[model samples]
Every structure is written in structure tokens, then in C-alpha cells.
Target: MTTTTSQATGSSAASDGRGARPDRRRRGKEGPAVAAVPVVPAPKLRRRPVLVAASVAAVCLGALLGVWTWSSTSNTHEVVALRQDVTRGETITQGDLVTVQVGLDPALKTIPGDRLSSLVGQRAAMDMAAGSLVTAAGVTKAVLPSEGMSVVGVALPPSLMPGERLLAGDLVRIVATPGQQGDLGQEPPATVAATVVGIYPNGENGETVVSLEVPEGQAAELAARAATGKVALVLDSRER
Candidate 1:
């Protein structure tokens, strides 16, 4: 009975050993066990040209916005300007003036546009061309027949006048012709200086009546010349 028991125990031990070997063989055949490794994707490369273009676009937008803001903040002012040419001593009227918007400048002194009514009937201190900006220095209380001056009207026949039309403020000379043939050769034409104040056409006589502003002392002489109908006008460019 003891021998049988020993054989049975040896068989049991052999079976156990066999089972362990198979498990080891199976593990070896399957290959070594491996731990899972985490995979991390590399970062995408930056587009340098696209980044640079985006930055430049942002800068340009900023500059344009700044310029727009500055322009909006600046303001303009209105001032009075001449609608038509005004001669020295001529009156200012609402029809002869206009309002103009101008950039504000501290050095520029001009009549305000709102003072249109106050400037009316005021005489011009100087000859101002059309579209000129009205200023404080260009106005006066009175300019007609200024001190020590007189206005005289002279009738000039077309034959005795030049083709160029006479205008106010023109410097002219009136030469007196002799009344008789005997006196023509004896004396040269008497000349006098005058400023044209106004001119009117005389359709009846086909003549032009020119009102001249002359010195008080010479008014009588110019009138005498006009009465004789022997006067001729000579434009003086040097006085211009």
C-alpha cells in the first residue's frame, strides 16, 4: 500500500510541473509584455508671412483711424467776403457781400459773417477786388469827395477818347484844346490830373460823361475845359 501511494504522489507532482511549463512556453511564444506609450503630436509650424501681414494690416488700420479722428475734431469758421468789386469810397451792401467758411487761423483777422447788416452802407476804405475777404482795415466811415477834393463831370466825344473803356480809380490827364484856330498854334494843350469817379454813356450826343475827382484847387480849371468842348482824355499807366 505504501509503494502505490508513493507512485500516485509522484504522478500528481509531475502533472503540476507540466502545467507550469506550458504556461511559461505560451507566454514566451506570445512575446514580452509591453507598457502603453503615450503619443504626443508636434506643434503646427507658424506661417511667418501670414503673421507679418496680419500685424501690418493692424498698424495701417490704426493710422487711418487716428487721421479720421483728428480731421473730425478740427473746426472751420465763417467770415464775410466780397461778392462784387468795391471801389474806394463806394458803399457796402448786403448784395455786395457773401459768407465764406475758412480754416481757423489766429493771425487772420476778418469781418465776421454775422456782421453783414452792420457793414452795410459803410464805405470801403480801399479798393477791394471781387471775392476778397472783408477785413477791419478795409472799411471807413466816409470816402466820397474826401478832404480837399471836388467832383466834376466832363463830356468826352468818342473821337477824343481811347478804345479802352475808363473805369473808376483810373488816373487820367485832361488836355484842353484851343477854342480858336489862332490860339491853337500859340499855346500847347493845358493838362490836368484827375481820378475817374464814374462814367455814363450819353446816347443822345453819342458821348461819354465821365465824373472826375480832382483837387479842390483844380476843379474850376477842369470845369472850364469841359464847357469849351475842347477837352481830350489821356490815360496814365504810371498812376495805376
Candidate 2:
């Protein structure tokens, strides 16, 4: 009985020793309990070289366009402009012109403000409105009523002239009509070629006073016919 007890004790001791060694070995092999670290998926390395370059290029282009627009709009010029309304054939005085800053087109013809002094005493070739830009073709230096030409004023009712509006520089003919007695055997009507110079409306008498430029020799005859009020106006073709 003693020996059996001894054997049983020895076996139990051996079993316990084997189990403790295995547990110690496992603990040593596995390090301290590691804390779970969240893995942030390595920041997705999506490289878009084309897209990045395009974005950069777009920003640069926008800046360049803005600068170009500013430069274009800031370009300005000092030019001459009319300060008041001026009728055809009227002389341009200092008071009639002003210097102005403007952005002018390349194709536009403008008289520079520096030439303002030169424009004095020059005649306007056509009717010019207030605030209009003075151009090279707007003024003339030619002596009006050329040496052989004489200006005559003729007043006529609407019935004796064409319905079309008459403007300065129009070519016209003044024709004499028979007197109220109506002479049947009278010679052909007399006609005088003339150029329109100025037109004035006579509101009180319902007549238009037209200033005409005619040959010096014919001026007296045209004046005589016009005084009798038996003449009509014929507008000639204005082409060229």
C-alpha cells in the first residue's frame, strides 16, 4: 500500500510540472497583450497628373485673360470733339471744339486735339451735331462762294418745290413760269442751274427760304425771276 501511494503521488507531480512548463512557454512566446491599432488604409495613392496639370493651367489662363482685358480697355487717346452744334458752311471757332479722352478704333479717323488750333476759321462741310468727334473730312479750307459764284436767296412755297427734303450740296434748277395772264405765245421757260447752300424755314408765311449759289452772270436774272414769285425748283440727281 505504501509503494502504490508513492507511485500515484509521483505521477501527479509529473503531470502538474508538464502542464505548468507548457503554459510558461506559451506566455513567453506570445508578447504582452497587444492593443488593437486601427489600420488607416495607406492614403489611397491616386495620382492624376493630367487633372492636376489641367487645373493649374486653367488658373493661369484665367489670370492672363483678365490682364489682357484690362490692358486693352485702358488704352485711350486724346482727340478733338465738337462742343456745340454747327451748321454746314459755318466757321469752326475755339468755342466749338473740345478735347476728350476716348478709346478709338483703329479704323476711325479722328482729328487730334493738338490740331484744335488749326481747325479755327475752318468751315464745316456738313451739318455737325453737338458732342460729335471731329474727323479729317468734317472741315474744309476752301473759300466759300468761289470767285465766279454768287449766292442768291429765294423764298418759295411748298407747291413750287419738290416734296423731297432739300439738303445743302444738292444740285437744282430754277425754272421760270408764265405770269398770271398766261401768255400763250411766250418763249420756252428760262432755267438756271444752281447749287443749294442753305435752307431756312419761314413758319409765319409758310415758305422756305433757300440760299442758292449760281454763276455771277446768272445771279441777277435768277434774283429777278425769284422776286416775281413765278419760279419752281427742280432737284437734280445727286449721284456722284
Candidate 3:
């Protein structure tokens, strides 16, 4: 009886031991972590590694964006840099110091298409607005033929014809007949050319006075002709 009792106790003890060991295993599996967690420090993921990774990603994205923009902007047109002295576009005003398309030379007096050749240092009058057609007249100044000359006139139709009858811009024809010369010589025939000059009023003869110039060599001949010749008045054509 004692032996059987002892055997039954042994079997019960082994079964209880096995069951407690399984409970201990379950408790170990349910435990939090191997290290003791402290209340002082809050758990935080490693931030520097994540931040570095994010920065690297941003730099990569920016580089790609910049490359895309550069590719799109590849096509470009030509650009020209204008110099301060070189003229091109029209200027706005006469007082405008920043002038362009200047008429450097006025005497070039070229025809229509040649106007550009002269616009160097010369300034333009206000009437020459920019982009407008620069006519030959607009680019050049008008010149009167008699600006520089000395003139002298004598009476025509013998002595009494009035000088007031003549005006400038009028054409005249000169005629001369031979005069008494030294004993055996014949006087020279009169020489003539068309003439137009400004006139000064001459109340002395109750007529206008006119001025004329002669070549130094021809003055004596002209005077001799004037002494013996007739001066006739004619009209000039207004067309030219």
C-alpha cells in the first residue's frame, strides 16, 4: 500500500512541475523588454539618421528639378549690345542728349537712299521724328547761292534806265559792242553768263540795286564791257 501511495504522489508532483514550467514560459514571453524602462527618459526614435536621410532626399529632388528647368530653357534667341556711339533707332527730341540716328555730315547732300550714310555726329531737328521717313530735304539744310559774294551793277539802256526795275533771283543777259580803243586796235566782244543774286534797293536811280562778283582776271574785261554794253533783264524758271 505504501509503495503504491508513493508512486501516485511522484506522478502528481511531476505533472504539477510540468504545468508550472509552462506558466513560467508564458510569463517570460509576455514580459516587456530585457532592459528596465525608466520613468525619467521618454523613449525617442533616433532622429539624426532620419533627418540626414530626408536632407539627402531633398537635395536629390532639387538637383533633378534644376536639370529639368535647364533642359526646358535650352532654346534662346540672339541678343545684340548697342554701343553708345553707334546710331540705330530714332531719337525722341533735340534736347535729348541720348540721341541716335544722328546726321554726322550735312554736306553729304546725298539722294534719298543715301541718308543713312551721313547720320554720324550731326544732330537732327525736332521735325525729324524717329521711324518716320527721312526725306532728302529733311536731312539737308537749304543753301542760298549768293550767301558769299560781292556785287556791283551798272545802268542798262544807256544812262537813264532806273536800277529799281531789277530784282534778285532774276536772270540777266549781258551784251557789249566794241568801244574806241587805242589808235589801231579793235575792242573785244562782250562775254556773258547767266546771273542770279540778291538785290539792294537803290533810291539814287529810283530803282533796286544789285550786287555782282567777277573773277579777278575778268573784272577789267567786265568793266570795259559794262562801259560799252547793254544789260538786259530776264526771268528765272521757278520749277527747280
109-201: candidate 3 lDDT, tens digit per residue: 323333343443332322343344343443323232225433456444424333344433445545454335424336553445434344455
Better of 1 and 2 by lDDT: 2
C-alpha lDDT of residue 122 in model 2: 88
lDDT of 2: 0.90
TM for every model, in the order presented, reads: 0.63, 0.67, 0.27
Candidate 2: tens digits of C-alpha lDDT, residues 103-134: 89888899988989999988888889999999
Ranking by lDDT: 2, 1, 3
Q: Local distance difference test, per candidate?
A: 0.86, 0.90, 0.46
Compose the digit string of candidate 1's lDDT tens values, residues 107-142: 777888898789998878788999989998998776
How many clashing residue pairs appear in each of the predictions shown? 0, 0, 10
RMSD of each: 11.6, 8.5, 21.4
Model 1: residue 49 alpha-carbon error in angstroms:
9.4
Pairs clashing in candidate 3?
Answer: 103-122, 104-120, 104-121, 104-122, 151-211, 151-212, 152-212, 163-208, 164-207, 164-208
